[model samples]
Target: MFRNRQEAGRRLAAALASFRKERPVILALPRGGVPVASEVADSLGAPLDLVLVRKIGVPGQPEFAMGAVAEGAPLVTLRNEPVVHALGIADSDFEAVRDRELIEIERRRRAYLGDRPRVDVAGRVAILVDDGIATGMTMRAAGRATALQRPSRVVVAAPVASSEIAADLRREFDKVVCLEECDDLFAIGVHYADFSQVGDEDVRRILSHHATVAG
Candidate 1:
């Protein structure tokens, strides 16, 4: 098991060392992703940014994601069509949840980033970082939203992910960097010794530190 988010971030940074010259922007999916992306930005001397994405949970089973919404001018939403159809989820109901997630996304963006201008990913590589992937719905939304920004390439990086989910992510991102992919993946915490819940304050602190360093 990995020691903690910091250790995971350092290892992930090493795996992505080749991209230092490319100067890829590190877009973290907060609040867990902030610490991981902070290390990457520091190691690569790249700008740190947020790519907020929220999962659309099934009505009764909140852990089972039916879709997700990603931040953008025109928000990006990815639906797990088969699951929705199987559950007989109405479009109206789905739209309602998506709209709620959009509000949360905006709230997080402001909380974590304040009024900082978003980093332009146009014609540059955009690396999306998260602590880990479970169902992969959130990252799928993030990738689609990032793609709309016209980045030259989109790379998804995480410390660990479900082997099956990683394969699905490969189709969405230009590259997927996952250190460990296990078939028996249960919870992301299972792979880390200190998988504490990351809070909004922690995210803000990390972003502040990055800004100070960049300045």
Candidate 2:
């Protein structure tokens, strides 16, 4: 098991050392991802940014993701049609949840980012970082959304993830970098000894630190 997010980040940075020359931008999924991405950005001497995406959970079963929405200039949404159809989720119902998530996304963007101009991903390799992946819905949505920015390539990097999910992500991202992939992965926290909850303040602090370092 990884010691913590910092250790995981350092290991992940080592694995991605070859990309230092490419100068890829590190786009982290906020809250948990910020801490991990902070170390990566510093190690690679790359600009740090966010790929805000939220999973649209199934009604009554919030753990079951039906789709995900990514915040951007126009926003990007990806739905699992099979899951939605099988569950008989109506358009109105789906819209309601998506709308709610959008609001939360705006709130987070404001809280964590404020008015900072987003890093340009155009023609540059965009590396998406997170603590781990389970269903892979959030990362998938974030990838598709980042694609809209016309990055030269999209790479998803994480410390731990399910082997099956990592394979699935390969189709969406140009490259997937996962330090530990377990077929029988249970929870993301299981791999981290200190998987404490990451708060907005923590995210803000990390981002601020990266910004200062980059400058």
Candidate 3:
């Protein structure tokens, strides 16, 4: 298990050493991904930015992600078809959750990033980093959003992910770089010793720090 998110990011950065030559732009899925992506951006001397994806969870069961919505030029969304069908979630209900998440995505974008310009990924590799992958919904949405910007290649990096999810992500991203593979990732927190909630302040702090370092 990772001692903490920072340690996990350091390990993940080491694994991603080869990407340094490509001059990748790191996009993190905040607020949990900020710390992890910071190490990578620092290691590779790359520009860091946020993807701003919010999970659309099931009604009443908020921990269970039904899908995710990501902020983009025209916005991007992904739904868990099996979960929606199995749970018999109606279109109206799904729309309600999606709309609510879109608002939060905007709020986070304003809060953490403010008027800062987005890093251009058009001709460079874009590395999307998250603390870990559980349902893969958020990461997929983030990938889709990144794709819209016409990156030369899209890469997803995480500290740990289920073996099945890692393999499945290959179809969505050009490269998948996960430090640890597990047969069953019961929860992303299970792999971290200090998996505390990442607060808004933490997100803002990391972004500010990265901007200073980049400048």
Number of the predicted model whose TM-score against the real structure is largest: 3
List, residue by residue over 29-109, the lDDT tens digit for candidate 1: 988888999999999999898999999998878778999999887888889999999999999989998888878887887
Give the C-alpha lDDT of model 3.
0.90
Candidate 2: misplaced stretches above 4 Å? Answer: 213-215
Q: Please, what is the TM-score per model?
A: 0.95, 0.95, 0.97
RMSD of candidate 1 to the truth, in angstroms, is 1.4
* C-alpha lDDT of all candidate models, in order: 0.90, 0.91, 0.90
Q: Per-residue alpha-carbon lDDT of model 3 for 54-96, expressed as tens digits? A: 9999999978888899988788888899999999999899999
Q: Model 1: runs farther than 4 Å from truth?
A: 212-215
True-structure RMSD, every candidate: 1.4, 1.3, 1.1
Clashing pairs in 2: none
Per-residue C-alpha lDDT of model 2 across residues 77-139, encoded as one tens digit per residue:
878899999999999999899999999999998998999888989999999999999888899
In model 3, residue pairs whose N, Cα or C atoms come closer than 3 Å (at least 3 residues apart or on different chains), thus clashing, are: none
